[model samples]
Target: MAVTLADYEKVVGPEVMDEIRTLAGYVRHKSLQNINSTPVGGGVAEILTRMIPLLRELGVDATWDVIKGNEAFYAVTKAFHNALHGHPETITPKMLEVFRENTAMNLEEMKLEGDVLFIHDPQPAGLIDKKPTIGRQWIWRCHIDVSNPDPAVWEFLRPWVERYDAAVFSMPDFAREMPIPQFRIAPSIDPLSDKNRDLEPEVVRGVLERFGIDPERPVLTQISRFDRLKDPLGVIESYRMVRRHCDCQLVLAGGGADDDPEGAEVLREVEEAAAKDPDIHVLLLPPFSDLEINALVRGSTIVFQKSIREGFGLTVSEGLWKGKPVIGGAVGGIRLQIINGVTGFLIHSPEGAANRAVELLSNPELCRKLGENGQRYVRENFLITRHVKDYLLLMLALDHPGERVVRLAGI
Candidate 1:
């Protein structure tokens, strides 16, 4: 979707887009290469799908590259991901050997000749080992929440992480005490994209109908991959609790990412848990189902993100932007997005989530109030325009480290 900066004026105001253009001048004509593991599965790919085109529109020669890996490679990376979220997992010597082998293969194949190379996530983190040979500015963008990461995993990744000239994290607390400068650039949503943009009433109704859902009744939905960290089974339990208090339907929608092998297993677990419940709708949406997802959030009474350990929780922002109160876990970026009863309530368990859902379903006026607050909060803080502006600033900081001030007109 060609979402130009000019197309965002109605949602973000012309002044904001104008300021972004002014900032873009500083990094104009510079080549930036972004590398990650997947092309269409997770949030990193989703963000780059929109970002690279916008960066090019602002005169930067921006390109995105995806690393190649087999099922074994992805399985090892998935384990490392779970451990990074503080889950206890055995990191064996064989796993480290596989990770190193894959990283070396990618480094040899990837053409790293950009003025600024932005390596994202741990999958390609070991690419930093070639920094001295390439001799260019490298910024590592970590989109995971490593607040209490497994020490062994962190120590394993630390040497490669420290090799970057700078690092980018979704939250400040996710940063470690590395020697390089760390930038906190929260992931953002494209308001004009197919996922967050407005849909016709018929389109919304069609989506609900396609899923055999009733629009007149209260609907609770959570959109994320069928992963353990997302706590889909926990969401089902919470839905049951709320069902006892009120007659509402629950929709657990999302498919497995291409790089995550545990998705089918997790989906089976959720299906088994939701068996015999006619009101619970378990949808296995395929990739590029943004319009359906948009309709799901837009047509719902409320949204739930109940993650055990979250990175940035961009879905919360998407739901809030669509004017729905989101009940999320009190963790990671959820804390930044939900203001605990102001924008939305933060819950620690399924009981707390069910209680909050009861309160919201019972009070339409309060739900509207919180939804309005959340929409405005996301517009002010979490939209793609602001995220692009932050990246522009980070580019400046990387280019000139010691300067007290940066002029957007000068590189």
Candidate 2:
């Protein structure tokens, strides 16, 4: 069932509905074009899938565009992703040429239109080179932890980034000390999406059975792409640590994106790590397995996101939105989602994560309290409604530069 804006009022409160109506009214006819690397797998695509329609339904002319890139392009972009996240990497001149060539191909082929163009992440950041000709307000929405980016890669990408009218970072810490205006807008999760919606008990059971997960034991699950940064191996290690005390089953399930070339390699490593533990189930979900992901999260005794570095942990938000107590790494946007002992626990080490997971699994009341608090946290802040409203307000601010207060809608 498609979730209408009215669903948000019931979940979040009518304040969100009134805000949406008012903010949307100002930008009802304004066109928005969202360009990103893939139309599947990652959070950017997932958010856009739900967000574009909701924006259109609310009277904004929002459109989504996926930038086409070949395997070589994705390979280079993967390296860029690593470097942006402060990982040590080597980007040769050849890789630079390939990235530039691919960007040129896209620029020539893709239609550049809309009053506002939102280029998501580093993959499609170069689209702004055409801004002079496209004559639209280009906003660079970077969903990566570029707090300490590799100098070489940053230098290469910085010039292109400077071309944008404004930039958005998931957390204030993720922002680079550049001249452009930066906004700290955290990413959100849709409560009504297939990945976070309410599920029937039988549906959850069937999914668990199909994946060979035994619901008889406590289930610890982590839903994320098979990325090294997500620390799938570390999650396995943490689960092993917790398993020493609790007889719980661990399930690692996530889909790979077209832009992430290292997914298969990481999956193999994760598979090998779980080889000796029959209790550990490794499920490689295909791109469109939102409901399956939702079921796994819903059925989990404890949900975790042990990312080494993250832009903003949307999966954590998704779990929190589902009223599940989450244990996320104390980094990036995960910190913003978990209020430490209130909503969920955020830890720095695998041992800390395991200890907390065991603690949460043992105490049902604490778990319920954490989950309830998390849901309310998501309701008040991280939802597509708030994201859209922020964009609308930003658009008005951009359109009228000197206006201190752009009344988005007349109450």
Candidate 3:
């Protein structure tokens, strides 16, 4: 069943719904087409899946399209992804050639038809080349932490990125010193979505039992793709460290994106590291397993997003929304989500994560306080309604470039 604005109203309230509708009215005439590498897996696709429907419900013409990529092309993009996250990956000339060829192929096949062409991440950023000829407002939304991206990779993509009318990033620090206008629009989660929606105690317990996780035992989970940047191995290490003091189970659960070719290899590595521990349940969940994921997070005593690098970890917010005190690495968007001792604890090492995990597990009162604070924080800042408002405001701002105040009629 398609979710309506009324459905979201129940989660975000009337004031927020009213604001979204008002903003949508300003840009309803303009068509929005979101282009990314994969239509499944990763936060970008998950967000667009939930967002587009709501945008259209508000009378805005919104559509989504995915750029096609082969295995080799995806491998190159995966390397680019790692490098953009500040990982040391050698960018070969052949890799650059592979990217260009695949992007060019997509460019020829895709229609540049939207009034606002929203290109997401570096994968389909090359699509911006047609902006001049198509005469449309192109906005490159970078969903990665490129503040310290590999010089070679950044240089290669910088020219293409600068051709856009404006650029949007998850954080101000992720922004580059580009000529185009830059905006910081944080990513958000749909509170009403299957992944974050409220679940019955029985349903949560059943899902846990099915996964062989004991409901009585304290559950520590990290729901993300099996990528090195997410540091699945490090998460296991943290679980082992916590095991010495606490009698708890760790759930490392996630699914791979179609655009990410390195998932299988990383999964194998994680499995091998977790094989010795019976309590460490490594799950490679299939796509659209939002209900299971929701159960895993909701059932867990504590949530972990021990990412070495991240582009605004949505899972952190998802955990927080479920009222779980998330212990995340002090990096990238995780920094923005976890407010040290307020919402959740921010850790730099597996030892640090484990230390926090034991503390929270032992003290139920502190956990409840942090969880309550985290949930309220997410409601105030990081929900789908707020995300839509930012985009709508940006579209309106584009109409009056360089203006200090964007005066919308009848507001």
Candidate 4:
């Protein structure tokens, strides 16, 4: 069931996939190598998994490699993540040492030869300093919303970020006033990926029953890493308020990542909060449980990606792609996803989320309408083909700057 370029033609016509092939020809000669911290877990890994192969299909010499990092290194990077998300933390000398040591380790082993070297997130930002040594075009792709970042942490990472040939962010607001040319490229979900493909009703029910969830009850589900920013406990509280009015069940299912150490602590806290509620089903799935997660989301009456801060909660698009209405927090790219009662509702507090959830539960028509609206919206705006097209355009933009007349398959 691995997706090929031709497979994309099924979801988004041969015309669209053909256009991608034509655009890929523009940059087929140059090499593209993507470097990030982990090979699994988190949005970056998930995106690269689907994007790499499709790029190669278009005849681009693209490859993906993961950086080596230990527990201490990830711990520092985790704090760096939180800080960039607007939770300021004191960066210690020990943490700096750990980051540098891991960066050096990766630098020694990794082959820095791609014509376009794409570095993702803060975990491997230090690699930008080595760009001069390799003399290749480097692009720093920031997936976090650093609009109001921790001052100290932003200043510390700014110099390394400035060194890149260009910087790409999810939203314009997410970008800072840096000298480097900045571009906004939102993340996307692959419609043909295991996590977004169509699932049989029996399979959905089986997964729900396996997790001790009642298939008869209307399920409100949230599938994300057990990270604090995802606000899993807050989701439980919101579901509690909705339960007071409607007899709906809640499911919080996610797995841990190697780069995120606090997932265990957050999962434990969520468990304690949902302990008294027999209706709340908590599932800590192991890695590569895409089919199971897909089934869980597909079976839901409604979905939630209630992150306190998000880059682009692909979970929102994943739910929408499955034709389920998503209630997401109004932050970062979440704002870009929700069209205010059209595609889905925008929630601020638990009361807001509860109100929308209750409304959706009360009106089956509204839920169906929103799902229809969102699925179409995503089809036009947020699929893997569009994402690959944008990246290819970025490569072209970087290579041939300021050309009035461009070329493509009439794209």
Q: CA lDDT of each candidate?
A: 0.90, 0.87, 0.91, 0.88
TM-scores for every candidate against the unseen true structure: 0.92, 0.90, 0.91, 0.90
lDDT of 4 by residue, 1-411 (tens): 667887888888988887888888888889998999899877789889889988998999989988888888887988888888788688987887888788888888888878999999988888887877878888899988788888878887888899988899988888899888888898888888789888889999998899888899899999988988898988999999998899999999998765455788898899999999899988999878999999999989999999997777888988888888899999878888889899999999888999999999999999999999999989988998999999998888777555655654543
Q: Write the per-residue lDDT of candidate 1 for residues 13-99, one digit (tens) a residue.
A: 988888788878887757889999998867888889888888888887889988889888998998999899888999999999999
By lDDT, the candidates rank as 3, 1, 4, 2
TM-score of 3: 0.91
Candidate 2 global CA lDDT score? 0.87
For lDDT, the strongest prediction is 3
Prediction 1 TM-score vs. true: 0.92
The candidate 2 region of ten consecutive residues with least summed lDDT is 402-411
- Residue pairs clashing in model 2 are none
Better of 2 and 3 by lDDT: 3
Task: Assess candidate 1 and give its lDDT.
Answer: 0.90
Candidate 2, residues 14-68: lDDT per residue as tens digits? 8778877887788777799899999876678888988888888888899999999
Q: Which residue pairs does candidate 3 place in steric collision?
A: none
Clashes of 2: 0
Point out where model 2 deviates above 4 Å: 256-273, 402-411
Best by TM-score: 1
